[model samples]
Target: MTRMIDIIVPVYGGYEESLRCLQSVVSNPQQTPYRLLIINDASPDPRIHEDLRQFAARHDHVELLENKENLGFVATVNRGMAFSEDNDVVLLNSDTEVANDWLDRLVAAAGRDERIGTLTPFSNNATICSFPRFCQSSAMPDQWDVASLDALFSRVNVGEVVDLPTGVGFCQYIRRVCLRETGLFDVERFGRGYGEENDFCRRAARLGWRNVLCCDVFVFHEGGVSFSHEQAERIAQSQEVLQQLHPDYHALVEKHIQQDPARLQRTRVLLEMLRTSPRKKVLHLTHHLGGGTKKHIRELSVWLTGGMDALVIRPVEGGGAMLSFGATDSAPGLFFSLPQMYPQLLELLRAAGVSRLHFHHTLGLETCLWGLPHDLQLPFDVTLHDYYFINAHPSQTDTKGRYTPDLDAQSSSYPLTVSLEEWQDNQRQLLQKAQRVIAPSAWAVREFQRYYPGLNYLVAWHPDSEKQMPWPAVENPYRGERPLRVLVLGALSPEKGADILESVAVAAHKESAPLEFHLLGYAYRPLADAVIEHGAYSEADLPRHLQELQPDLVWFTAQWPETYSYTLSEMLLAGLPIVAPDIGAFPERVRHRPLTWIEPWDSSPEQWLRWFREIRDFLAQQNRHARPWQDQPVPRGAEGFYRDSYLSEMESAGEKELPAVDDAWLGSLLLQSRQAEGRQGRLSRKERLLMHLLMLRQGRVGRLVSRLVPVNVQRKLKRKLSRKPIHELHRK
Candidate 1:
């Protein structure tokens, strides 16, 4: 059926915005026949009157109406809606710009179902209907113009509509039949606008009508144009009335936000934008457990800023993967179930403009990722951040948590469904397909090559600093009578030598040695009270903490061979005197420095304490501010690798032969895997409790708890909440 929409644009003030709105409407005519009925509601600004008159006179289909007295927004829109009897009416704000048959798209969306009482288009400032961010005003994406973006939206989200509690009045399409049933806006309650549309939507909903967001249309809203001065006052009054009339309104909206049914649609448009852009994008695949690998990807993304875009894929805990976009750590990510959506995942990546793949680590990811490059036919690169590629043990450690040269000796000790040989073979196959393989250090290159034997490797150190200042040796921090302060850095898991840390602290206390220990990062479990645990610290916060601690020496008790230590890089940059395990890249990176000691990898607590005492005596003999500064050439780190190899133009994996797997068979495998993993169905009771606590942290109860409890107590509680049970850790 043919539809005619009366586009009722109520003009109050803001002549520039009003003119742009009318001009855009004129430039982009709707495919569906529509009459532009512009109503001037006694605009305070006289300039809008003559402009509207001339605008109407120039166009044959334009109809202009004016009120003698100012009737306000709620009354003005109602007057216009009543102006057209049979046809549908669109209450368009005069501060908005429409493009590319926007009205036609709205009408088409309304035609999808008779029960759809009203529809709103996506806008830059339309609250819940806003793009990029919901319930917040955002500027139109800089790369796109209105017409182009509108066209893209129309192409990508055709026939898509997300249900909303209310249709935003900025660009609302109200059906005439629904309007007749629901009646007009309550002008008495909402005099100058605000919650009037929400009230109407609620009334319509009560009458079994739906309010929806038309995903295919794009409109630019220059908000606060009309009723700018009276906004705060009117909004408060409208909200009060809404609460009294529709008590469930706020709850419904909040529920919608929590559910976020429109996230996929928004992500689709965002990905489509990236897909069409000329800039090359690289997708980095890593594990969910953050460490140096996650840091490397984040730094890589920042380094690729303006040169290329970076996307990261990390496995979810149970059985999915999360894809985080752009350079910022806080940038939004999407999570999807794996195996089941394996084929669709490839298609989505293709749509997201992922031209190249960079595997940082894939330990916890699903089996599908092992064959990703071959399945998707995308050329890739690899970075060896750990020994996960060659052994089940990430640190290449024995059962006793010490470096082991014989990789196969403790194979059975590491729990896994597959044999260590099978695991290594899978990783080997995955690595053999890479276009290039990179390691952060020469030591890492040597270790990885011992397993693979023939694959060529590139050495690129992880980027540490943008400003390479000289390594300035600090003054001796030890004063005559005080116990020497020893500091440790990074997360202290078992392989990281948390046990060694605990033993050393205990030994010092027992022997009454003049030694004090402080930890900058957390341990897998709580340590001795004597070892001051400062908990987790960010790279940015490290310098400030170091200055305050004024440690005599920094110690690393790592029990295994590390591929590359970012913490070591930080300590080196700080120029502090150090003691580290003899194994791993520590000797390779820091052996040549003076005032540095590399201890045996399996050093006893008493031996570590003796070294600390010797260091204290050595510092006591030196001058208060003694050592000189010297400059050294900085290595080409991860940033350099990104700049050299990844910044270059790349080809997309176009039209690859996707794997054809039987759905029923694949589903059976996935179900069996879930059942075996004991992760089938919804969240467990404990998980639900955790989720409830998280919710409370954002609600009134959270606020009350914050006020009633001491900050220190709160911090302790937070630490407890984030830590896994000791039994769970032991099980692993």
Candidate 2:
């Protein structure tokens, strides 16, 4: 016969906590035949009664019992136990949140030994089961998601059961036979609760019933949910009653706790095993845990964790550290000033047993590690997301709408600020210390080589595609006699081709061309009414929006070169025909794909319109010719690419011992960086002095100086001053 278990929860107040407990039980279905019984012990709040009634009506397996008079927790639980006469009983507190397989693990543990009468699981706030200590309540790490923690616990303490003097009352799983032998809780002796479970456990121990703690399972307990206001009085009364009933009860309990010297040591070992068993520990450093970089880090971390232990450390706003376990689990954050908190951060890393480090974007938090690569003793890799190191403006676009390939060219257009130059020099120095420099695309790799040159680097495509394809088939949005639907995705900023879109839409409307433009992202400025704005959409909602507003073709109209186009990769997965500029990674991404047309980077408004019409007509002809959408295999997903690339790089890096940090050399480099920052951008000292003197001169003298010098001469002189070779300056 299948064993049955009845879970009884006694509730007095805290409606929200009670509701969460019920929801967790219902959501996490267990394999064993079980029923949930919630006993309301005359709660003063009418809302609690109504909520319980509603919950009972909604769930057929749930039974709600309301006491007519105020019966304390001990009596309420004893009354609830009568319903479980023929089944095992689990006295679960209303404030506890259970995870999946929690019941199965407990039942399995109980079945391990026939003499085992009661079983308890580890919890964040239970008395003996509380982590890091046997009695004190400590908060669980913030990065602990239920699933991950459950898995970690199972892996760490499988088959490791410990004998406990008493079971924690918050979540006690008692066999029906043991309940029958020991009888219900001693309600007369400990009427209002606090020590009733312990009193009963001591009684059961006299009858040769052993209480065990199943270390493999973890349950979250939000302690002190019921009768919290009367805790001190209840505890004092219960203690006096317990001492009278059993003369040596307190001394025996203390003796049992103090005698177990291995318990704390075993607990620490279990925690360490859960943290670092069967995997290399990797700590990823990034700025913020949001946006594209956030998504990238999350994906990589999750994938890497399958074979390794991965954690992400990012700065919280207002200063502190937050550690994320994989994509879902995050520990509670701590605040500390960057740079000053570097030693503390290092200590945290050491405690976590981090073996390797991966650095992503560190824009706002770079000050924390001004020369981290030189100081850190672990093997590390840096992934370049943009051209921040080579150019002041990360987009590598100058003020005149031109691409600047070299630092000298960039300096001629946009000079660096004091702080910015220091940051760039630091970036260069960090790159020199990296085990490998990873780029998302070959275009990015080429750009990095062109600028930095000769440092080890490799192209590892980001896992940019969504794991599951939200849409099954590409729906043809084209219809006879209506304008062709053209779709553009991304923020409508100037750099993202908002101006180009406006010009194209206006031209299409004026020319009466067979086209209609639909913008599907946030717009800074108002567009013509002819251009339909779909507004901003979250990652989850974007696919649904695309399916709802199916367009004939997707367009990529960025004013500057894209390092890697996440949208373009998504559109390809959707099997939609794309029109993109022949610049940056766009060309390489859509190289051999069918129904893709690439226009020149310098394509004018008229040229863009002409290409759009031609592409639209070409797609129409292809449809007429009966071309299959799935004529070619979809490109390989990026996760596999990244996994292979990363593993290969790690192997190639080998076990070369990193050289010790040369503080003197590092100090010189930092000094040069500070000196560079102090130097005025572009202009020499003489030019700045001359300009100051010219400003002080009267109108005639100033005008004469301005005419004689001219703006062109000043620009030429500034460029000459800024053109000092980077290597020469660094050497000096």
Candidate 3:
């Protein structure tokens, strides 16, 4: 008779996610008898032991093992497996989510052939929510079976068994014979992380045991688990050991990681219903995984409109993207577009099919960039966009609430550029956390060097201007002979200069410049009285409108330091020379072309008309020189503005040393250390978090939040002056 299935969870920190993991595991609807084995690896934070004690007291099937010393990965996995009395021992990563029948499936698969020593499961996507929620991210894909099927959905066979390559990562179902013969996990040889699985699998295979993949068993795994920097270093050191153990496996591991031919993003909608946001979720997860955070500067990426995807990269990976948003106390009228449609964007990025992500931005990022723990786990470099140093007492103003576009002053206390003590307090964590930093501009490079001294950073420039030009140059589709119809595109808000455009339209009508102007965009008012009120036209409507109105010039006027104008880029691509405010990155992106800049002094309609007329006449004279900005010789380096200039130099790059720990209400530590750590050693990430709470260090801000808000609240609430998160966007 098959005695029992012994399960092991060796963790350091990760308390909450761990709790959820256990709840899922113990409640795993399997008829086969099972027992849970939890090893505490002398975790610095102790609450892990306390939670285990509480859990063990309640569950008869659970057993607890404590390591008095902080036994690294090698000893931990082996120690956990040793505590198992069952014939079949399942080595499971604490961060993994297992399906209900995951156990039976793996056991059956591994038990199929006497030579089958171990069984593995094909993986599923995992997510990390954006900052702040880095403390508590509940986002994940659904593992439940489909109650109904859709024609567009990928046919999932659910429980059908399948084979695996060499190793069974995360979920490894090992046989008793293999363990007895080869010993559990090449303890000394494999050490921890990466190649250990392959090493073990190879060994099992060599021992005449077959390693099968139980494709039917779906498992969810986070990138890394909660741990301190020291533990992480120790984990990295294991890589050398892995290469030494089996030199041949080195190529295989490198091939698997680097040769990820298809762009598999962290976020992708698993089912037809939702998408994940990788950036946001990955940020949140950095805390859970043995990783950290970094400061980031915002860039007015012209041409690539942020829309909503920038807000969340997880939905595109794990679940489907979000669509509509409800009005919130913070940002009213802030429409959340395309979150649910992120799969399309992810598909494009993947289609780029580059092995690693290579992108750039001009400015430095904010102090509180990616909200995650400081133990940065990823071993790769991503362009940081920027880094800065703080000097004197600084005041910042950006992102200060502009949900209504024209309502507030055109700047925010956007901290992405500061290197002040306060900024460092927010950024040091990410700085200490990111694997490598890439600064696109020399200014950004200086800032990064000033703050994160000796850190591995590259002062790289964005690929030359030509690469940035949009594709498929089209002739003026709106061929006009009569009224030289003009199009004013963008949100019909105050800063968008909609009112100004209204005056321009009236002025044009009065002058009878043989021109008719139609405002095209999403209607924002109670009702759109004109052709378009929101003033923002969809891509599909653009061609139709062009064919119908045959507009001559597309004017994009934003009375703000708006960078990289997407509208301008589109106009340039459409062979339509545009009239846009020459500020921020706009001048840099669409340069050496006939355009009009809105000067502050020229507020009168006549003055605007004169300039508009000159612009139109220039367009008429240019003989369809409407090719992309590629052929246009825009003077380089002329486009320069500190994205964080609003922030005093004192605050641009961190000034003072790293900030003192947040004194705000570290009233208690969650686990109180005693129960937090186990006999074997440290607790998991969840345990450490609980321990911090128990120690009164953080997590209970009673008066801070009074209500539960949905994810959709951000966009709708940004316009509410009273709502701080969104209220920063106050109307002028």
Candidate 4:
């Protein structure tokens, strides 16, 4: 008995392609008997849906199954193959144009071989000379010659056995019997699209079924049969169907591409730091239009050269991670992200003569670090822009009201970093391949080092210049005869201590020298039921809001450990004395920089009121002592601090002694130390001079080596070692 091939073609959008594919199939010259199963994957575009109805309404042998709603490709095919009933189903791509004798040749191949339980008409993905490509219309190269495939791709062979690797999508004629033996495509996987047919073919073989390619009846696949760009959307509508249609294939695809190629690419291409370069390279990974963190390089560049106009960021095209983030609820693994993108970044760097990579991110590093490509692993430097540990849970507020990770089952709808073990695991993996670690605050460096020792931690403190605006040396913006304006900025949260301040607002104002409090940003949105919303301020608008609010002091006010407070740096740069809680990095950055540290009350409202009252008085007196204060120069000049610190931090290895960093990242460690020094500080001239000279090595390695030549090398070593150590700028 001769077997018939029932071809299932999913029709949705691209009506033009569908009609052309239909004409190729039904009009075959081979006169092979077959049924055309057209699955209308209820497309969003009604025009295409209507066209499908009209076309199917006319064909006799063509059976139409219009899905009530779009049920993706696999589902539609499962239904199409069901309607196909009793015949072999060839799941075909509508984008493909068929050959005249495709069905007859496939039917003949199956008729001749009882063991052939699966079959496909071959098509290659790389479209070399398939179509006319402005090739001067010379003697055109012949399209695919089946003889070539037989010679080159003949992989399977045995006595009376014709074996071949899995087929590419064009026309796959699946044996209905094979379904009973191997079962249907796994409905759980959302991994495959182009590779689905190959997966099916392999599974059938594993179940002792054989496949044959009827090359004699070759199809001139106008190509991209099952999945064109638009068809993919239709495919998503029925991932469930595809899961049932093709199982393990989905797993392979997800493992390889993560449903998004960009993620896979970014994870693959992260480069290592250049060991030979003058300056260490770090790959900065930004997930989105990051607000406060992404512009770090731009600010640092300007601060490094003394003027914004002198140093500018020039983006290298098609470099860095293969994956670029849009917006995502969860972390896409490193295998699918930055690790994959290193090669491209390295290529771009090599072309531009860049030697190292600097990696930065506002989100946690674990996602990208965990899934990086093993073969392509590169030495890298990292600057963590934010910590998940900052602030307290919303339902569970700390003193301030920031949303800490909700650890309770009810609060943690999504998985969050739960414990020190998980955090350390991720942190250790992040620093596993790093040449050096760079952070903006002392507290960040210290806290990370607490669990992860043996690694070099470079403290590139955040600069005090972030919030500085161009202006003449002028009078204070908020000083007045009115009650001193006290400003508290940050999102509404316990860690931010906004609620605590609100609790004290009325009491602080009741004193004889009452203080006027102004709370800003998201932190005040809800708790300060009395707060005035500043609308939505982008980073650009934040400074303007500060100027208009005219507060005596801008409080950083974070209750958790901060890596380096961008806001703290901005506050110091503004030349307004700060009043912030001594937690995280805030205490170290603002300790000696003309700022008053205010510890939160242990529990008593009285101690809290006293602290608030004292701060109010201090602001009032500072304003009273205004004329000379306004005219006075900044205590230690602010502008050159970044440049001086950068030069100093990278000047010497003696500055840091972390056992973690070996000789490999000494240069990166120094550079990061200088940058950390630059990130948060008001450096004294004497301290700045010593730091610069220590970190700033003169001339080439050979030249300095020649200069270090001494009459008594041992005495010289002792003398160099005896130099007074530079105290931790603010070690408290």
Candidate 5:
């Protein structure tokens, strides 16, 4: 039996996109018999009407339909469906372009299983059916045309499909049998667009039919070209109708998002694309601890321009590693269990055609990962963010969190499963394989070479993404009339001088000195009552919080030698008068600035107070106390240099053409992580409510509701419902 499909494209606006869509439809070759049914639903554009007539005259397979008046999208699509005679129907948008055998693949997928009612193809902008990232719009990869992408999908994703709660309508194919049973789209409820296809899919699903994503086909959807102006309003209205008819619609979609059954298929196609492309991809291996190291990788990924892409493999819970393209919500991380799946991980990396390896830190990673460069035979680089290479503890601090200069004594007292020498040997072996050893500061280079001599290192200053602006001159209320206000930034772990901050706060309070202290970040434990903790803050919001506080002096009490500090860079941008210990990068970073003061690293809390008092007295004597702060120049533009440093001409381990290995285990592990059923069960009552609120906020109606609600009230509700942020809840 010959299968036929009627491709119904409802054209209303967007002249150029409509022309291209029809041209592509007519030009593309299809294995199955199909007719192009172009509908001009009372379009205001006369050029489109003439073009449609020309298309109908030029091609016998093409048929044209016209609406005497503006009947909207639901009526237009129903008219086309009514014109079809017992044939499967495809509701393609006017802004979509088709490629080689796209219709053939959709028809093939529909015929594969008898119960499959509707199917949507992979697209660049088709919501749940979108590629590169599901449920998000993705741009076409550089240097690739629509035909090339479609061909790649056809080749790589042959016979691949995933179940979808609802079929996306950008290029949806509906079976003739299923269409008859579910009936045409609800014209009365959804006269224009948006929720019509979802309603049809839901109705079909209730009648024991399945909606699927046809992964092998790729279409280009230039979305929102038709009815772009009224999109938000129409979408909001459509959501209300959907909720009323199918109360479980949101839940079904949310469940699909949680499970993410299409992840493996998407990953496979993406890896294949990257593998074949000429673009250079560098894999960065880092720890789970979110700090400067993670921040560095993220910035580097964003900064690297031209022929370069950065992927990350970071340690996760359960001793596994998650390979992620970038630090973004759309870019999902693929998990692979460590030690047990080390071989699989290696094969996966090679298959992706990773050009080089970059190790940022190894705190929580498996010891076996130390030999990755050697095992994979790939040139690599190692950036020394801390002293993990020299000591088991990255900070190299004593019990009191003070810098322990005596290496021999510290090494002797170090607690480890292996001897200090053995541990250092392992690190030495890893460093030896690196094509380049990177240090962010000159101080870091000097300190690192003290332990690992004769190793060449590259000094690249970390780039600051935050652009600086001059701060308005505000008279420090406490400068001359009251106690001088001091501020400390960042999370103060023991090695970061938490104890010192506590002691200084207590000393200032006990003596009733003309000084006050505030911490923008939390300490390791609760500090003295005198120290005011402002809790934690994100880097993006740091400047706003700092401006609000208007501290007379910014203080850093780090007890260890810092390699490079991102927070220090932020402070530099703020251009506030600074006080820090004379150790690590602080002295070099803050050198030659008149308003900056450096205290001895080993200075006692009382001595630190005296230094603060001296600064207070000096400011009091100054002719002008309040002046507009200017941004201090910081080193930037290392993106190109870093890109060159990481990129290599040497062939990757994958270039040797290793035999294919079954990646089923990796897929299974990834699926297990995404489908962790206990996630919802562990949520508290408040968290459950917060989760539902998050769902509502993410839905179409959410945007409308946000506009209706007062901004401050919405914020308060968010704060109360989300005591713990949504991201943290997801992690749990």
Candidate 6:
């Protein structure tokens, strides 16, 4: 048969404190099969007995023990212990609160050794087991939450147990074998309170039983609540009685404390370990674990695992999964309503001791930055991948693929259903709520500042840029080349200057220029016959390809202001000459590198040909001698930069309180943006009318209209008709 444990709380006065103790026990019940016995020691207040009776009536495991007359605390606890004949007993004061898993941890530690007689856990004011100091009164720090502290204790001391000369009685657990061997507390000598537990522990220790302190558990004690007025007198009398019973008690305790001055040091070390554990729990909320953003997040997550416990929370097919690094478990339907989700999320965060949250992208996910509750008090930051927050079209380009300088203007070319004003408002709300904002380049920071000024931001390069590349100083890579090979990397879309590549390839082939163009990305359009296509390559495959193909020059032909170019950084690291457009971060990245040429954004095809010719000439001239690449100090890698930024934020998070964000205004803006994105790709009334008219004139009428109208005149009419009011187009 499994032996049950009994927890005996000896109540004196202070009905409110006693009630709180009982309520804490009831709320967080022990996992082990245990019974609670509340002994009312004939308190002056009648309400204390009444409350205990009502509580015991409601709980089957709880029993009320009423004394006909007032019997002090020691006798009351002794009487309650007699009721548990074959079970282990726990002496708990009525003015203390128990945390979850408190009993299980303590009992488990005691059961580890058969000779373990008494076990006690650390408490706020327990004499020997008091945290940070022995026999000193202290309270839990305000910065430490109950749940976080409980988690910290579990993490810091997994199986640590220490031997002590005496056990504090505020909350002590005594083994059944120890009680049977050493007998109960000496209530006759120490009648009132205070030194009974110490006397009992000393007796047990003499009988070859160990009194251990379970450092992994913490219980809150409201010290002296029951005996506040008479504690001094009671303590003095108990000491006198204890000295008479055991003459060498005080000397033995003093010798034990003096022998290990590190006892206090050990306690402090353990507490500090719990307080500053390197295992910072972080939850990364993103869309999917793929693409450039996902790759960046994965690198950052791996780096964080050096001193943190990182987890990724992303939406799966149907629901989502709270996955550790490289774990496979699809938790379906984890997110629901806000009220239902907050508690579940909070519980998970508390259990994991998550202190920081990072949001990357939330395109497909229902819950976004605006949905997060502010009361959680978790410090969070957002990474801006693109201008998605400022505009529905992330590129902020017009219909003809040109950058739009004015943020407030409505574009007729790429008409997203959302207005510029609404987009700006939503962006403002998100930026204001975030504790920090991270961008990849200075251009992105400047762009964001244009909308929301005076906001502090962090510029973190891609983590891949931090890799070390040995300079090819000894060997000239362009030796005996039949023609200077030029490589264009990245997706070959129009935004990446696919047209420019085609024009350059055709122009070079027609003019018989001494340059060979090789394309190493997804070819979106049919390339010119002269250009060689290598198809698409993964990030890992790119280095091998670059080594094998040893292109003399690389072109960064991006049309958009490239936020940050990973390809350009890689080429520069390899000491290869590069020809890139003078836009975005290209000029800033390739600043001091020799054999580099930059073309204007609006440069013509002939101008690109001219730059290529100049680069080829420069490479030929350098091939005469072994041109040692110009050595410059390497920039700080992404891992170090991100780690420093993260640690700085974490260290400062506790010192200052984040200003409260206006959730109502933010929520409205988010709702409006969501509604706009949902309605995207739907045709407007003018588009529908034009489609109908074109379909109606597909036969003889279309032919006659086409013949009668001049081409330029017809194009002017269509352009004028397409530019209509945005609000009117959205009307039902």
Q: lDDT of each structure?
A: 0.77, 0.69, 0.45, 0.48, 0.78, 0.67
Using TM-score as the yardstick, the better of models 3 and 6 is 6
In angstroms, how far off is 568's CA in candidate 6?
2.4
Residue 359 shift from truth in candidate 6, angstroms: 2.4
Best by lDDT: 5
What is candidate 6's local distance difference test score?
0.67
lDDT of 4 by residue, 242-297 (tens): 46655654574444322221211111111111111233222345433344565576
lDDT of 3 by residue, 1-732 (tens): 765888877766677767767777886677677788877777666677788778877888888788888776667888877765446788777776665566766666665577777776545431111111111233232222311211112223333333333554466778777878877766665554555666777676677877665544556566466644454675566666766766765575455433321111111112122222121111111110100021121122211212111221211111222111111111101111233323333333222221222122212221122321221212223454312223211111123222222221223333233334565565455455445555443434444465567666544333333444343443443333565556787555444565566667677776677566677673222222323343455666877766665667676755544423445655665666456654434554454554424354225567777776665565555555344434554333422212221111211112212212221211111111112212213233544443343234223452123123321242234222121211112111
Candidate ordering by TM-score (highest first): 5, 1, 2, 6, 4, 3
* Candidate 4 error regions (>4 Å): 1-282, 286-291, 301-354, 361-377, 384-423, 463-481, 506-513, 538-547, 601-606, 618-732
| Model 2 accuracy (lDDT, Cα) | 0.69
Displacement of the residue 98 alpha carbon in candidate 1, Å: 11
TM per prediction:
0.66, 0.57, 0.38, 0.39, 0.72, 0.49
Better of 4 and 6 by lDDT: 6
* Model 2 stretches with alpha carbons more than 4 Å out: 1-6, 9-217, 220-274, 316-322, 328-332, 368-374, 400-415, 419-424, 464-480, 624-641, 648-732
For model 6, the stretches where C-alpha displacement exceeds 4 angstroms are 1-278, 315-343, 367-369, 373-375, 400-402, 407-415, 466-476, 479-481, 624-640, 651-732
Candidate 6 lDDT tens digits, 290-386: 5566676666755554555455666532232333322122111123233324444454344334567777765545443345536456778888776
What is candidate 3's TM-score against the reference? Answer: 0.38
Candidate 2 residue pairs in clash (backbone atoms < 3 Å): 142-330, 142-331, 142-332, 143-329, 143-330, 143-331, 320-335
